[model samples]
Target chain A: MTNENAITVKNLTKTFGDFTAVDAISFEVGKGEVFGFLGANGAGKTTAMKMLIGISKPTKGEANVAGFDVRTQAEDIKKSIGYMSQRFSLYNDLTIKENIVFFGGIYGLKKSVIKAKSKNLIDELGLHDEADKLVGSLPLGWKQKVSFSVALLHDPKIIFLDEPTGGVDPITRRQFWEMIYREANNGKTIFVTTHYMDEAEYCDRVSIMVAGKIEALDTPKNLKEKYKVDSMNKVFLKLARNIE
Target chain B: MSISIKNISKSYGKVKALTDISFDIKQGELFGLIGPDGAGKTTLFRILTTLLFPDKGEATVADYDIIKDYKDIRSHAGYMPGRFSLYQDLTVAENLTFFATIFGTTIEENYDLIKDIYMQIEPFKNRRAGKLSGGMKQKLALSCALIHKPKVLFLDEPTTGVDPVSRKEFWEMLKRLQKKDITILVSTPYMDEAELCDRIALITDGEILQVDTPQAIMQAFPKTIYKVRTSETYRLIKDLKTYPKTHSAYPFGEYLHFTSTDENLDPEELIHFLEQKKHTQIEVEKIDASIEDTFMELTHTREVNAHD
Candidate 1:
């Protein structure tokens, strides 16, 4: 049995005056699946993600995110998904508990529920001793963990993480993937974009973007086998080289 | 040796940024400082470049003492910071010339030094640095850094945010620079990049973990590992962590890199165990150790040792 598509984009295109940022890209992300969007710098990965997350309006085509139309029903779409990026979204000055409260409040969670969930999350991430410390003082790895937990505060059906593990150590990055695997098991669809090709291997299905077009899309193993390469980095290089 | 550091230590207030770090880079060799954020790669680089002082220990770059010969060191060493610090409003050509003039040299005087690298960005020489693409900016930065023909180059996370294609190009440029017999010291968080270096120092939390050729480092790792995947990936990882024979289990790209304490452990036994757990789509394959695997093991042991 196939999983229901949590996201669907058909001929999705976004333009800025003369330039087409996302040119008629079409794909569907299955429910609870980890979808990897791989691309180089300015490959329109961010622009495409922005459109699907209901931030930027697509110049043409259609996208149904969590069953809401990106154009006509952006408000509803915004209510159902979470987002975290390299330029951390949470307030740095706030304590971990306070940050959770503020983010949970934005999601309209009740005060009591927020308090309980905050406690649980803090404990689960092993931040109990550091719960009251300002987020700015925490290490990058720990900070990322908190931001990820905060993004899940609303229990959104989907989360869009843009280079979530950038500049982090391999151990922390490996741990972050474990968190992602846990979330995927919990039925949360993850739509992630990264330039790190090794990360492509972690995704259940990956789509490569180059010069505003979907260049290749397949499982990491299949893509490697088809391209006759040993690693995803080589697969990405091969695709990127062909266009350049 | 192009660069040699002895017992280098630095501290920021109460926090130690680097501790007892010592290494040597032979002439024209590419050395990588491999670590995560807060690993003190930046601190060591700054100290070597004479941008900061170490609280303890000593070092030399291009045969100049980092402490007493700060002036001479500045003239003979080039540094590309983690961030692009070139003038945003100046065109690529203008930035190159400005750097050249400040170094008391002319672009023509050091033209031969940066020729190959500069040629890549020459087409965009008139474009403002801010207007250039990431790859272009990186090249422009390298060109400016080399305009004075410094004997040693220090690049801190030069490819951190660069595209894979540009990263490949930048490393290729580094290879060419190495042929010029200029020692290069680079720090990067990406583990796969360690393989490109002639030798690498694995650092974490401001201390050196190990220093050796990437191949030798991986060869030193003592583990029999398998890449395993099942339909229930999350649960399988948790279950495998508790498996009696398992040494460690963590997520790899598409599968879990499972290491067992038992060297001659049979794969069939693990298969039968997973089969009993009713997991579907089970696939297991043995794979060679990667640099990352070695780094993780070293750091993990260090953490456990610190705790004890």
Candidate 2:
């Protein structure tokens, strides 16, 4: 079962001082599954993602991401996964192409390969005009698109995107999802976290966290059925209402 | 009108934030200003709240002109900017006390008004506002905004970056606040939140695209929309775009929301077409248009119009 599972978890937990940030949570994700990690602010989504990504050590339990043990094989896990975090993850001062090149280089991409990939990406996104422009000068939507492209540069097995569509308009959000769907179609597993319920519906499976615990995990359609709700928003509300 | 905007326009030197924006809000109604980033929502909000001046036209809040009676408007208006703006060094209780004191009131006097929201964060009243969680900070900010019991409340993207559970809770709080007979104007980029308002005005690139109840807006959609899916969704959009009858094709959650110019189209026809294209697991079902669909339709036309 573990061999086929893209990600396998059992009793993953994390704590900070007196607070149990991420309670014991277990789940299995298939290859190419767009697994959504959703929760209210302070609901332990970040803590749990960190553990799975191998940046933060777990307080207890066992979990594997991309067939690498999060505890003992952190380096292997790091090399096999891509990340597009919300903050301090991208260089605003660098040009669009430089940012891509830097990310590719850090992933150990060869210089010649980085140059070739940068050219191809610039052409693909039709950003040849802004190749030398500072990423900070670009619009929010454009910045997100470029950052997403950078995340895919290394072609990691699983990509972790934290609120990639936040603050962008509906059109841009849809375009971003299209990119995600394209990746998933190519058998790349996508792990995304977002606050928008409508975006949750796009995920193949979604996990709702509440008070440091996984309160619900099912296909968006099934979760709606289980909660007797028509939308993911109401399902989240139902789960959160039970919390203190 | 509880609020009125007549041909209001604003510019920041070379950039036009809002252009000839006009709308009206009835008394005690929850109105939404919907747009994406750089769509001039914040500029419009600033002008309506009397914090910034418009280059042309006029607006009124609580029947007080934005320019002539700005003092009156200021006294009766409560604003929560998209960005959290509170004395970060101050504790939750301290910030509430400071805001209330500046409004010539006391926390005890307005405790009942903000009690529901405050009680949720009261446990951490001693923590610095900067150290509070995102949802808690937003709730506290709302409490501060309401301490003065303003007749009008303006919240700019209050739920942005907040989680779904917290977003639901926040909207519920707004519903409860509406019971006080206060007219509310809230702006957000998320289209789903637009449906919660009594009425919404969809804005894009500094212009009002449409204004109506969410239900009415959905019904106003001119085309029959269908949610279609096939084995290879990556190619679904491209393939549909090439179909001679395809009017519009866009990827939604698990399916593509498609429309065809052909009249009385059957799902079988679409499935048969896709199967012929060597696609498997074809599923096509007619679905009602969502607010987002309407928004995209409205904005999509403008994209073409801009070319002309």
Candidate 3:
């Protein structure tokens, strides 16, 4: 478990019944890096993330997330990493601030700290006027931002964003990446999965998963060069189509 | 075939969905209504298709007032919703036929228009629509939408969940359809798809941010662009932002698409500075701005304007 690598996965595999959702795959994400986990729908990106986060079990593999063995130290790994699923997990009935407070309280933040953090998060997101507004009343982009900020409330070492920018506008997606960059600057690792190839270009290094395998791994530019494609979209298409 | 919207506004209960949104679609033009989810694209489409009436303002699709000539408008306009709302249990052929029947036409009447698309999925036409792949479903949906030989078509994010190849195919079909003198107004969140449109209106939060040809939008980008590539491109992007002349720096593929406040700044100076910082394999070159870049600039400029 080295400090340089925020996540170390070796021959990781996950099976559901008889089908292997995540085949033998190995990859590493450096500390404070935004690692893009890219794949098509049901391409095992989510399954791999689930295993690393310790909620789902791996059939056969070895992994360390934030220097904690995912198998024996599931609790420690969970405590040290923040996760925002593709689905909006915040309670729609609660106020924006209330959702933050609720998540913060669960993470064992002090009441005063939660309050101050909520205020800061709201202001930073330009949602100061909407702090008292119900989470359901906000737009999808705002909800995504709030969900992201809440994921950072516990100050976890690694944050996993599963298609966090899904259905968001290009402007909001840019803003969301800014927030992720800020967190990365603060030395937090970001592991994100997205179907958007343009968004994948923003990551430090991206791993393209196809048919439950890590078919390509490199900086977006290198992958493009390797695939002899101008765009990441083309690189993905080449790899995905080749695998098929 | 011209469509115009004047001072259109709509609300759902207390929520203002759209406000004074005005735009036009020229005949045989591939117009794009670009926006995110809940950006009132569907609302506007519904109003123009005669499914929902706007709270205020007037709209005409293909020279017929949406309100006064709802029946005529309905007959001449084809709409594909954001969600695949076709009958799931129905076979692909059945769905297409049903839509054709609803429009008082049979598949054979307009078979030539959808023949290219329909032929791709003709083998699986007997398969249930729900059991088809995303790409197949897209083709089937487009075929169903075109079954009536409509003069104008409104596709609400037709390529949202489809694969990259399917998206490309769908756009090609739209281009082929445009040859028939059909006015097309399509909405999508994918910025890349915006370039495929003849003209696009970038919308956000119930307001139209910018409207122009994709080329025009790119040309309007108010900054000199540089593509900065290096060994640690990600780190370079972060470090470049701290440079005094940097206005905006974001990772674009293996390079950083950076805009500098000082457009006259030399690339040699940047390379030297990176060299001084012990950066490796650095390459800086002036490059063209993309539609996404233009969209970001427009949105940011609008936000700054609103704040002011």
Candidate 4:
């Protein structure tokens, strides 16, 4: 049955040699949902995300993202999803417009479509003044916004952001989240991982991973209430401590 | 020991790393250097700790010039770099001992200062420094930094990669260390952490943006702020920004922190405007400005003023 859920996993597990990076986790993300995947450093959030994006194979269990089986339809899954990593993945030496065109070319978009979309994105993000500037010359916040817009160049069904706002200022982070919310409103699912607990509150639902396991998964309000905490930061602390 | 920085400036080729930055850190004060990455926080820390010399300006630690008294400065201060620089292959105990020996002091002499932080990770003292968890590694690094009982401690983003709980625990440790009357200078990117500092200097792009107590900074916010939560938060932000009376509308927590160009704009009028814009379940009330809000306002104001 094709439900509203964009992603579905059952007993998903990922192991590297003897180490189980993601241990039998299961979750579902609704269409157009902003799902926050949160955990401390070295937790299984990235591993699970890699499995969902079909980059890493799951040792056991079944998983489907964007309605395709992760193992058998890995290529199809890749085409249907966009990913922005914590590390800036764009070429630093290239100009802003050049980078977007290059990514569009890789995705096999028509030159006209690339041009039109690039203009729209540049206008939307107010990057017109810096369009010809080298990506390396731009500030961290602008580069991140460009990276995110580049990720969505192909109009994928879902976007996976791994710690997208790692080092940006609060104002920039707010602006970034605004862009994410805009994408979600356009019926694109956003699955993101973040170390910033405050950012997790912006998600429709969030999953807290600890020790390769999903310790908590729910709306921010529900999780906060369940943990008897005032903020998502406090809730995460309680859960992380308990896991340890 | 007190710290004084005068007209400090550094550049890498054409890019100015720090620009005429000047600040004085009182003795035994838990002074915080708050800024984003590439804000010259690390450069300032390195210059203070005598690792790097500034092309311009002078600094003194405990009454000794940073350049002429490099040895004394190095011996009198402990520095925990942003990145874990301890020997990865060495065990926690070995690393601690190594740092202690480098300073010509044994752990026994400074054991009382680091007893609290060191005790937490003592059980895993045999584990390699690289093998420890982020929190554990932080504690071990901190303990090693304190192993020599330096007069002043310099920690550069010590809680960057650690968890929230660990960050809180680390701050508590600093508080305890403060009681011993050892001056501490910590730099952090997290705005929330600034409130924990006795006094904070907000740095950006190698410029000292503002330096004050957290409360003083918050009080200096030049606008009347309100928290607005609505069912249509995304649209509400857009709509509020378009409002003629609105000065700024930014997201904070679950609500949007908004300020108006007109101070006389009342809550009822805001609710009416939002309702007119089809926003449901609207909640609007005047609220206290936070350090993040204050910093954003200051920085944005600076940008605007510069443009003018």
- Winning candidate number (DockQ): 1
Interface RMSD of each: 1.2, 1.6, 2.5, 1.5
Off by over 4 Å in 1: A1-3, B280-286
What residue runs in model 2 are displaced by over 4 Å at the alpha carbon?
A1-3, B230-232, B263-268, B279-281
Docking class of 1: medium
Clashing pairs in 1: A201-B253, A202-B253
Q: What is the lDDT for B239 in model 1?
A: 88
Greater-lDDT candidate between 2 and 3:
2
Candidate that scores best on TM-score: 1
Worst 10 residues of 4 chain A by lDDT: A1-10
Instruction: Give candidate 4's chain B TM-score.
Output: 0.97
State the lDDT of candidate 3 residue by residue for B131-237, as single tens digits. 98777888888899899999999998888755575577689899999998889999988888999999999887788878899998888888999988887644686
Cα error of candidate 2 at position B20, Å: 1.8
What's candidate 4's DockQ score? 0.62
- Candidate 2 lDDT, B111-141, residue by residue in tens: 8889999999999999999999898999999
Local accuracy of candidate 4 as per-residue lDDT tens digits, A1-244: 1259999999999888999888899999999999999887778877888889998888999899999999999999989999998585689999999999999999999999999999999999888889999999877888899999999999999999988887687788899999999999889999998778888889989998888999999999899899888999999888888877
Evaluation by TM-score, superior candidate among 1 and 2: 1
Range of the 10 consecutive residues with the lowest summed lDDT in candidate 2 chain A: A1-10
lDDT of 1: 0.90
lDDT score for residue B125 of model 4? 91
* Pairs with backbone N, CA or C atoms under 3 Å apart (clashes), candidate 2: none
Candidate 3 regions with alpha-carbon error over 4 angstroms: A1-5, A10-20, A58-77, A108-113, A123-126, B13-16, B91-94, B119-128, B161-163, B229-251, B258-284
TM-score of 4: 0.95
